[model samples]
Target: MFTQAKLIITAVVLAALIGLGTWWHLSRVHAAEKAVHAHYAVVLSEIREKTAAAVTAFRATETAWRSAIDKEAANGQARIDLARHDAAGARTERDRLLADVARYRTAARTAQHSSAPTAGPTTGDALDLFADLFSRADARAGELAEFADAAHAAGLTCERSFDALSRTKPATVQAPQSNQ
Candidate 1:
């Protein structure tokens, strides 16, 4: 009979097994996460480098444009001043747009930190420790999985054997044979 005590114990064991399974897989999951973060970091760095280069090129172009506009032999000082003021406005707009793009890119990442290390602890000590722990736990889970399978098969076999042995068979009768 599956008494309450037996039921409770089974529940506990099943829960423990699930917990172990989760821990075992956590190693792989964590590793995958670290890989993704590393990839993103590399990408972000590349983006920053490229952005800086682009900004440098933009400044150079603007400088050249300003030089050309200033050196223009226009007879009207008023027109020259107006053109310079417009160029300044364009510069302001460009700078504002660049700042907005950077801000939005940062915002896209959301909370910025969790389940990952921030610019700290370049040492591999803690990493090695967790790697070892996860490896051992996962290996243990593999062993337990084999045992769990065998136990399941054994339990089913035991139940079927008992059912066959304890079940009552119906009695059968044959008609009396006539003399031949």
Candidate 2:
């Protein structure tokens, strides 16, 4: 049996050890949490940057499509207008894809900050969607090139028709010749 003083000393020592252990555990947890938060911030920042880049590209495509459409419309070439309409539609699809990318980036940022699972599609899904969109844009560009060529040819035809009409001579009526 330990003496009363010894028992008291033992109890105090145990309490002190427990307190130190708790402090150490809490500090370690805090450090780990900070590290996790830093990593999440970095990941979210990367997603944001990629999303912004995609959005910028989409906007540029939209602008180019609009310009091409307006120019063709002003030229009064029906075939070109039709092709430009197709380009505009393609741009619209691109905008939608870019908008989805923006939503994904927003969700990722929110998930990172709140440490919660995002709803609906996963990040991978969004990435795949963007890849598909990019492929479609490439295809659309090729089609646009062909359409432009055809439209140019059609414009030349239109111009030739106008020139031919302009060069036409008016018919003149002559009085009947008098009998000798």
Candidate 3:
């Protein structure tokens, strides 16, 4: 009976020790898991901050480039409008001068038939007007050509800026996978 009692006590003590050891091990594991989770949270927070900053910088750069392109386009359009206005004015003036020449020619023919010495302005005056009109038309054409060249240059610059913007990489955030 004494030996049985001793053996029973010993078995109880061993079982208690084993339970205590298991509890201690489980607590340590839980602590380690908590520490790991805290570390991951800190890293994730840093990543989010960096990603947000990158996005902001990218947006600012994009806005600047777009603004520059728009300004260039507007300037080119203004130049084109000015050129058109000048060309239209030149055309109207040329037409008016041509009509004046025709009238003068008709008047001179009528005067010759009627045996009159006086007609209209001298031929030199008509020739001078025609030459001046031709010079102005040529100048207007040159202005139009310059406007076209400027517009093409602006278009090319805008295209290059757009291409650069497109090539820029966007910010990305990758989520951690769950073990479960």
Instruction: Using lDDT, give the best candidate's number.
Output: 3
lDDT of 2 by residue, 1-180 (tens): 569889999999999999999999999999999998987787777677767776776676566555555554556566656667767787677678667767876776567667656676556566657767776776777577767766775776567555544454333333333223
Model 1 poorest 10 in a row by lDDT: 170-179
Comparing 2 with 3 on lDDT, the higher-scoring candidate is: 3
- Cα-based lDDT at residue 99, candidate 1: 60
lDDT of 1 at 132: 58
For 1-180, candidate 3 gives per-residue lDDT tens digits of 999999999999999999999999999999999999998897788778777877787787777667666765776667666767766786677678667766766776666667745567555456557766766776676677666766765676567656655665554545544444
After superposition, candidate 3 runs with Cα above 4 Å error? 115-180
* Model 1 lDDT per residue over 1-180, tens place: 669889999999999999999998998899999998987787777677767777777676566554444433232344445545655565566557556644654454343333465687633545446555655665565556545554555565455444543452333333333223
Best candidate, TM-score:
3
lDDT of each: 0.58, 0.68, 0.71
Candidate 1 global CA lDDT score? 0.58
Name every residue pair that clashes in candidate 2: none
Residue 24 Cα positional deviation in candidate 3, in Å, after optimal superposition: 1.3
Residue 18 in candidate 1, Cα distance off native in Å: 4.1
